[model samples]
Target chain A: MVSSPATARSFARQEGGAGLRDSVWGARELLVALVARNLRMRYQRSALGFLWVLLNPVLTTLIMVGVFRYVLHIPVDQYWGFLISGYFAWIFIVHSVTESAGTIREHSYMARTLAFPADVLVISTLMSRILEFVLEIILVASLLAVFRHGGVPAAFALLPLAVALLVGMALALAYPIAAASVFFKDVEFALPVGFTLLGYLSPVFYPLALVPEAWRDLYSLNPMVGLLGIFHAILYDGRVPPFSLFAISAVEVTILLVIGRQLFRWKRSLFAEIV
Target chain B: MSSDVPRIECVGVTKRFYHYEHRTTTLQEFVFRQLAGKPLHVRTPTFHLEGFDLTVRTGESVALVGANGSGKSTALRLIAGIYPPTTGSIVTRGRLVAVIELGTTFQPELTGIENVELYAAALGMRRREVQASLSSILDFAGVDEFAEVPLKYYSSGMRSRLAFSIALGSDPEILLLDEVLAVGDVSFRAKCYDRLAAYAANGGTMVVVSHDMDSLPMLCTRAVWLEGGRSRLDGSVDAVVQAYLQSVTSSS
Candidate 1:
């Protein structure tokens, strides 16, 4: 249908905006298709093919658990279980953060050609990592069962909320990183180092108790302290996180997600030019 | 403001792109530039097209004919909504699709059929629509025999033909076709032109970017001649074509 000239003059932005709003329903299917395509292409043409999915986490866990349990003697109880939970959470964060920054830079062509919301790309990046993360979870579960270290905690009902918060945290951090990278290529370098330092600061490989008495509270101020602590609680200790700590992490992540979304919308328009 | 809306209206449009004097794409160079306190090496903004005005009414078939670097392709892309004009405004209604740089979404590792879905989806068709039309698309391209083979194994012509076939299935209200008619065979090229004529006859607006003067008159009711980032002339196809021919021959 032909629109009047006044409305027609504003067509580029407004019409595309309406098309985006109308197609919010399509976002889910598009994201699923993108995730499927990425996963397929990732392992495509390799001789081993889909075996890499199972072998990757298994190998990483084996090497790290062997090193810490035998080589270093870190002195944590049930170190195998601890590393499984810790590494699971750590890998998701690291993989998602490092790759998310380049998501826009990588799919710059699609963003220019298709008028879909740019957030779909960022969310799909997270979804692809989440799919791989799901595989890691399966490996962890089977290994935990095999070793007699795995059991559902009493607070298992809350596990879904905890997982949601972790996803929220990744999305919060990833949105800004991907959106801003279009303006400044420097994000490409800063994010990997930042996430690496974050890995060391969090109690991923080591126990949280290793932190000294005076600094433990200050260190808990790092949001991941509470976030990963919940993962530890559910998977390792069979206990619920302290309600106060859990609330703090959830609130922190919600705030970051809100701000990151704003920054993303502001930056989305300029992407076609710089990308 | 009129009651009738043109399919596309680009008024006082100017697009300026940064011309980097140095290769500063790396982080090390960025840091060194900051440490040394030198000016950023983007020398200046060069206008790809400046103060260009165009209006394509509904059901209009327009041709942008220009020599290399004359901004015809840029104008086509602007109308296609590939990117916004750096300055001024463009208003377009309907589902716009630009077939410029086909096979951008083609993954070499993907099979021919897979790339068909991926490229069509990238052009704004839903996955279901792409699937529904996949057989017909393949049938027309005559790549049905190798649909399961990886695109990397296909010759360049095969790849383009597949991409072109998929693009044809993308239901666009306003189609932006850049000089992509060079299919693998002459029959397919004829098929493409026939489809083009049918689409235009059915009142589908189009902005065709090509330098071929012979084909220009056949496809366009109106022709625009562009030179040095300006709309040098726009008139009926025969008049503008003749004028453009005279100018090129007289000047050279």
Candidate 2:
């Protein structure tokens, strides 16, 4: 017989702002619940459920190490450390983009009934991947400890910021891609190929210093260029990334986020209808 | 904020749905469609809800009775704010909760209790708020035995009961339900009636879309007959229901 007062008050306000606050804060907790849900769903009913978190990167790293260190004969010092750190960050961007693209469309049922912000579907999917990323970071740390490259540089203290930048890069890409995927299913098809191409463009396997000086600035425009560059500086070299690198990355991320937010907000209204 | 003002108001609300051929939901389809140079058959955007209007005052229960595709659910959707009107405006007051499709928000892979948290969170309820009512919600759903198991294991009836329990816990002032009353077992239906009777007694306004004629007079004070998205009759339950029944029989 009783009625909740909060939503009524918000509706009575006659403006859009009041209700938005509920969603904004409400999504924060939902994010946690969803992340937890995804992790449980992923690992459910398997004896080696938790082990897969550790095992996935281990298996992937073994293949990459065989291909890059032995087959390609790339001459990078501490290639083991480089491969995992770079690989973990790259996987975050790649998985976030691919998964976020389908998040809204896949969860269309919720869009038809529930009133939570649609973008959180994209955001929470990214958060779940980020949680996986955090687990994989443990792998990176162990590898770094085992490799002891240059005694694990002092700049490694900035690992947290490096992770943030990687996540930022994912968010920027996920926003636009998630919205576009709803209207054009081709987005989902193109994303994995796009990420593969993006891998060669970014310094996933090789070092950025190796790319010629003339191409470096143009390459730095990739956003991930600066993001991964900082990641390499901290985790690989144990030195803080140059402020100039951070500056350009900061600009790129800002512009990317602005464009992403604009596109997502513009197209979000049509989603319930078209989806 | 005046006592006389209607809690929910729809003014000339018309919603159009584009009828896409081949859907063209992919870039490949779109490109192919463009290369085809605009097929001879051009589909015009059609209005599902054309010039529809309704006003439900506070403390009133209205049942929307219509045949399939008669815009019963569409009207409920518009009031729930799931879809915006293509033209005109809809102004709503008071807290509202709509249950259009049961289990739409459940994540089947999660445990029953976890799904409760997830569903409540998606419905815009804060965590501590759900936490305070957590046990009570579980009790009401009567699925506490399967709470720790993944929801995929639960039967459809259990899922619907879970969804209804979460919606009921919200205690919304305005409840927009679309064919949701026949949610659970016979015992649950009786329980729903007892609770709904109490809810109506507390001055809650509700708009329900149901074809269950026998339950009309017992559940609602007013009945709105919508034909093709337009309000055909809006009057006391018995009068409008009788008119609608006559129209159906004569047309058939």
Candidate 3:
């Protein structure tokens, strides 16, 4: 029932703009099925199942808190709250981008054989990661509540905006990266190194105050800095992020999305041939 | 809704594939090529199909008969919207379901029933439609007993059977089949033919690519014989299949 009665339609190429939106809207069922399959496959064989979603961030945060708090002796108070908030946001971006970059190649056979929108693969990968990240955010909020007698911050109401911005940024990057990775094997090899460098460059582990004032403008150009700053401001500092941070992040996401969508649309039809 | 209206049309359709030789697959290689004043990627274009045209009306069954690499499958894929034609236009009316390489979209780790839902969705079927047809699909594939088992455990025959059943259950207005009848055992294939015949008789538009000369006439009323991507002959199934068979024997 999704499609109406026969109407003359051309299938020469995938459409763009509103036509592309309609195609995606028509394909929403496929998107849901793909996301469901992705979630199931992620933990199907693991004995711990969904626990792995929580365990990954918890375990990684514990190690970082141990190192920064005890061994490295960083001066930030309530380092667990600071680290957990920023780390969860950072990991979400990292996992979504890294996994999405290779999703088209992983499902190349399906892309070639099936006629569904190829971008659905990238979107579904991000959706599954987003679902996992939502669960991880709950865990972070609980830990923050326990550590601080103030309970969860009221500013946390703005957390959805932060998550939305993070996802928008991730998708903007993922579309182009996923499309390019199909042709260039280098993307697969280069992503981890790029993320590693980005991790050090962003304010994921340490406080932004430690960053020298002069270098902050250049650092903020990374996009993740603004996004992580938003998370940190709301979750750890219990306040709204500066309007400038939201503005910068929004502008960057818009530009990246436009470029990413154009590049992805141009390259997708070629995928069935190449991949 | 008119029976005379064309369900599928191809106008001067041409498909070309580039054979990449020493393609630049890395940034370093691209940079080196730029420094050396060489093209970023080198490839030779080969035409798979050229200036091909066909039209299938509603309730019509057509057979694309050709040897391997003659563009029958490529044409089917182009019509199915899998690949954009390199230099032409393809228009289709009605919901289309293509069984090109069955089970290729199925995940290995997912159970049989799960894959059915996934595959149905891939074919553009909604969740409710898939759920409604789920039992019949499983029963037709004869994999109902193992519906909960992962597809990785299914035999090759079982996988194709399940895939074919799902495609048929989708109630497609236009169905494209590329040598799908070659799968499964004898009885199952007979069942597949029966299902396809029933579909064709029920006013479903079908363009099938098959080499089984005997069965092509049984299912299709007309045949288009392709040679090197161009239609060499187009006529009633009996005449075209006979001529094609004669060419094959005489050439051999």
Best by DockQ: 3
Candidate 1 structure quality by residue, lDDT tens digits, A1-275 = 11121232233442431253234454555666677677778776676866876687778888998998999998988898888876887778778877877888898877665556678778877877776776676666556555644455465556667778888999998888888788777888887788889888999888899899899988887888888888888767767779987889989999999999889876676676678
- Which model, 2 or 3, shows the larger DockQ? 3
TM-scores of all candidate predictions against the true structure: 0.89, 0.91, 0.94
Q: What is the C-alpha RMSD of each candidate to the true structure, in Å?
A: 4.4, 5.0, 4.5
* Lowest summed lDDT window (length 10), candidate 2 chain B: B38-47
Task: Write out the backbone clash pairs for model 2.
Answer: A8-B95
For B1-252, candidate 1 gives per-residue lDDT tens digits of: 232678788887776666777646556677789899976475666777888899888678899887888888777767766656666688777777778776666778888887777676656677788889999998878889999999899888788788878777776777887886566777878887887788888887889887778887777899888988889999998898899889889999
The prediction achieving the highest TM-score against the true structure is: 3
DockQ of each: 0.29, 0.36, 0.47
Ranking by DockQ: 3, 2, 1
User: Of the pair 1 and 3, which is ahead by TM-score?
Assistant: 3
Sorted on lDDT, best first, the list reads: 3, 2, 1
Q: Point out where model 2 deviates above 4 Å.
A: A1-23, A149-152, B31-42
* Clash list (residue pairs), candidate 3: none
**lDDT comparing candidate 2 with the true structure:** 0.78
Considering every candidate listed, which one attains the maximal lDDT?
A: 3
Give the alpha carbon lDDT tens digit for every residue of B44-137 in model 3. 8777898899999989999999899999999999988888776667778788888999888888899999999999988888899999999999
